[model samples]
Target: MGNALRFLYGQCCSEPPTTTTTYGGAGDQQLGHHGVSSTSVGVSALAQHLYHFEITSQVPEGLSKHVSSSKKAQSNWYKKLSKAWRESKPPPKTPEEASRLVIRTLQRHQRPDIEVDARAVADGDTVTVYVSTSDAPESSRVPQEVHMAAVERNEARAHKNYTKADALQKQIKDAGYGVLHINNEEILARKYRIRLRGIDAPESAMPYGKEAKDELVKIIDGKCLKILIFDEDQYGRFVGDIYCNGIFVQELMLKKGLAWHYTAYDKRPELEKWEKSARAKRIGLWASSNPEMPWEWRKNRREHR
Candidate 1:
């Protein structure tokens, strides 16, 4: 009886035996025996937990979809920023300049369909433009006094002192520089005198001169312009093509008979065509049988002077 009791005690303390079993296919999972034993159940659960961990390890469980989206957005922004940096002439000089450039580029990207603005119209064939400080070339040199005035004006404005800011701004403007508020941002700009290319208008005292100037003003006043600079004239004016609201300025002047094609300087056939059209229609200066050429009038005036 004592020997039988010892054998029963040994059986109760011993672990249950496990049997290996092959699944349907050779590549399929091989598991332990499907017996009603604690060891087999624990072995199956462990395999399941490990399989789940392998899948989840590739991408952690706690991360959200927002993180992936943010990374994609950052990559897109980096691509655009790189392109803008390459195209930027005289690249950024400081952290502030870089920030401003990024902001301006993004704004332009957002409103690519809109037109840009010009400063003012000087005459029938001349325009005044303001180049923003951010767009200024590296070699551009601003007068020390003008730069100082600009700095002080910015500070004054920041402190809510409009009177002082206005005075400082006036001084800056007197020095041939100006601060323009574009898109609700303050931009310091340099002045440029631009002469319209491919056409010549009458002098202020000549026939239809006032009419030509008035017509140009009527078409471009308070409107933005796109200028393509060619060369600088002897009068320190930039000779360039001017487009206002998508209309070629020289073409308008020629079509209206307010200007001569100035074939000696510009040989574009389009200018000649427009002038001939206006002449045939007897528009503006064309109403006179023989209007004096502006160059001849200027030469005579110079000789008299």
Candidate 2:
């Protein structure tokens, strides 16, 4: 029976080893069993066939169903994730809009407000800006009217009406503003509280420094000075060359020797040449045998102090 069972099991498992068994009694009589036995030993074969049939019939359908469901679930999950990502992202802002937002934020933080208003003057070479506090009264804002006045003055200057032009220039200067004549045709003027450029003068002294200031004043104080703005100093003041009546103030001062060439900041290539010429001619401060450069004087004074 065991051998027959083994044979049946082998056949059920697709081809197995053949088995043969011999039973011997005490009297030396032998009983040999061969071929398949007519016993219930083939149960394992039936069970194995049933198991294989069940798996073959149901496994494909189960796999197909599972794959379809998993595909649908992944599609839905990806759709939801993409939708959420779009909702969470913010739109990009334009440059102008972003600048406005920044300004508003700064204002909210109690920062000082700066406003620029540009107006075209008649001559086409100038623009004017009137600056005033945000809380200033409407009547106190002078930028618009000043720009128009500057345009009128530029027209007058162009026509050689020096008297009228001078009067307007004085009015503008008295109002604490500077007028820029652009290409002798247009005007860009602004009302700004700024110190005079280059030379530092005392309130009262030998009037030498004041004389330098006055010379600058006579040339550029009331007339339309062409401003060549280069850069701003650490103090936020505009470091520029002032051209008065077509004269370079830096060169003028250097020629007269009234002012030493400010080599540290004034980087005009022609400065050294001008200084040499002035020294050879023995002009202004260079008239002295040992006239000290202003920078060296300032340094020495500071060190002594």
Q: Looking at model 2, report the run of 10 residues with the lowest lDDT sum.
A: 118-127
Mind giving the per-residue lDDT tens digits that candidate 2 earns over 129-215?
332222233224545545445556755765889999889778777765555432221223335323234433222122245455454
* Model 1: lDDT of residue 195: 89
As for candidate 2, its clashing pairs are 125-186, 126-187, 126-188, 127-188
Candidate 2 accuracy as TM-score: 0.35
In model 1, the runs with Cα more than 4 Å from the true position are 1-119, 136-148, 157-167, 181-185
Q: Return the top candidate by lDDT.
A: 1
Instruction: Record all residue pairs in model 1 with backbone atoms less than 3 Å apart, i.e. clashing.
Output: none
Error of 2 at 235 (Å): 2.3
lDDT of 1 by residue, 1-305 (tens): 11111211222113233434565687665543221123344333322222333444322122111121122222333345446655666544333444565556545533111122333655568767776543325114666677567666765766899999899978988877777655444555677888899999988789999888888877776666777899999999999997877898889999999999998899999999999999999999999999999999999999995
